[model samples]
Target: MLIDTHAHLNAPEFAEDRDEVISRARENGVSTVINIGFNRETIPTCLELAERYEFIYAVIGWHPQDAKDMTDADLEWIAELTRHPKVVGLGEMGLDYYWDTSPKDVQAEVFRKQIRLARELKLPIVIHNRDAHEDVIKILREEKAEEVGGVMHCFSGSWETAKLALEMNFYISFGGPLTFKNAKKPKEVAVQVPLDRLLVETDCPYLTPHPYRGKRNESGYVRLVAEEMANLRGLPYEEMIQITGDNAQRLFRLPARS
Candidate 1:
């Protein structure tokens, strides 16, 4: 069985046929899905999906793009929700320089707050780094995030960055980019990561893999990502799925599939 370490199955893109999408994922051997809920609008919906499906779990936090909108109450709200048994982690939170929707300083502060909160609750984090690797790493380091190490979701950074994150006890996760023909950096780094420290994802409703690029992504397509990862690591597809699935279970403290 496989686990989609990151996904947005709760996104509006799946509103029309979300059930079908989830069924397809299951049919494709995706046994578990870690869904991200990164902002006021999505947090509730994400939790709903987790509550609705036995195999779905939630990760709650504020997205850097919406950092300016987060308040003390929102943080408290997230803290309260983590008490839910299906809330597996705290994030999808980090710097996002590309969007620049939120000021870099605001994003950094919000990110720090979530990291601090995650540490307080003893929850592993799920990071979202986009065009802000240096600051993400710096803040993660300054905040001593290794205390509750996490996964670098949809990682698109260099090997050097991956190394630093790994040093901080972070698992390096790869998504659709790993399947791209010209994605040299991810391809290069995906092979070097120790199997135990590697994870796979779809980051669905976005980052759709090759052959399906330019189309809306779905959790089912994580199998394509796993296949590509298997090819990259020179392992059988089943073995790659087990390795990444096991890593996901370990990091999120998920129960073994019965």
Candidate 2:
């Protein structure tokens, strides 16, 4: 079974046929999906989706792009939601220099806050990083994020950076980019990341995998990502499915399903 460890089915792109999308995911062998929260508006939707679907789970926190808008009250509210059984982690949080919707300083401030919160709650975090790897790693190190560990979602870095993250007890999650024809770095990292430290995601509603590029992505397409990981690591497709699915299950503390 495949587990899409990262996805955004809560986005408006799925509003028209969300149910059908999820059903297609099950048909395609996706046994579980973790919906990630990017901001205030999507947090509730993420929780709702988790509640509505037995196989769906949620990770809630502010995205780096929306860091400036996050508030103390928002942090408290997120803490409250962590009481929910389906709130598996705290994040989708980190730095994003690609789009400075919030000042870099503000982004770092909020990122550390969430990291600290995740530690206190003993939940994993889902980090979102874009053109800000140095600071992200530095902060994670200083904050001692390894205490709770986390995932580097849609990892787009070199093996060296991945090694650093691994040393910090973080799993490296590959998304649709790993399947792109010209994505050399992600492919290289895919080959080097240990099987147990590897994970697969679609980051759906965006970064759709090959053959489906330019089209809206859904959780079902995680199979394509897993197949690509298998090809990169010279393993059978089903083996890739099992390893990555197990990695996600262990990381998110998800129970084994029949």
- List ranges where model 1 is wrong by over 4 Å: none
Which residue window of length 10 is worst by lDDT in model 2? 31-40
lDDT of 1 by residue, 154-256 (tens): 9899999999999999999999989999999999999999999999999999999999999999998999999999999899999999899989999999998
Candidate 2 residue-wise lDDT, 1-258, digit = tens: 799999999899999999999999999999999999867899999999999999999999989999999999999999999999998999999999999589999999999999999999999999999999899999999999999998999999888899999999999999998889999989988999988999999999899999999999999999999999999899999999999888889999998778
| Superposition error at 175 for model 1 (Å) | 0.5
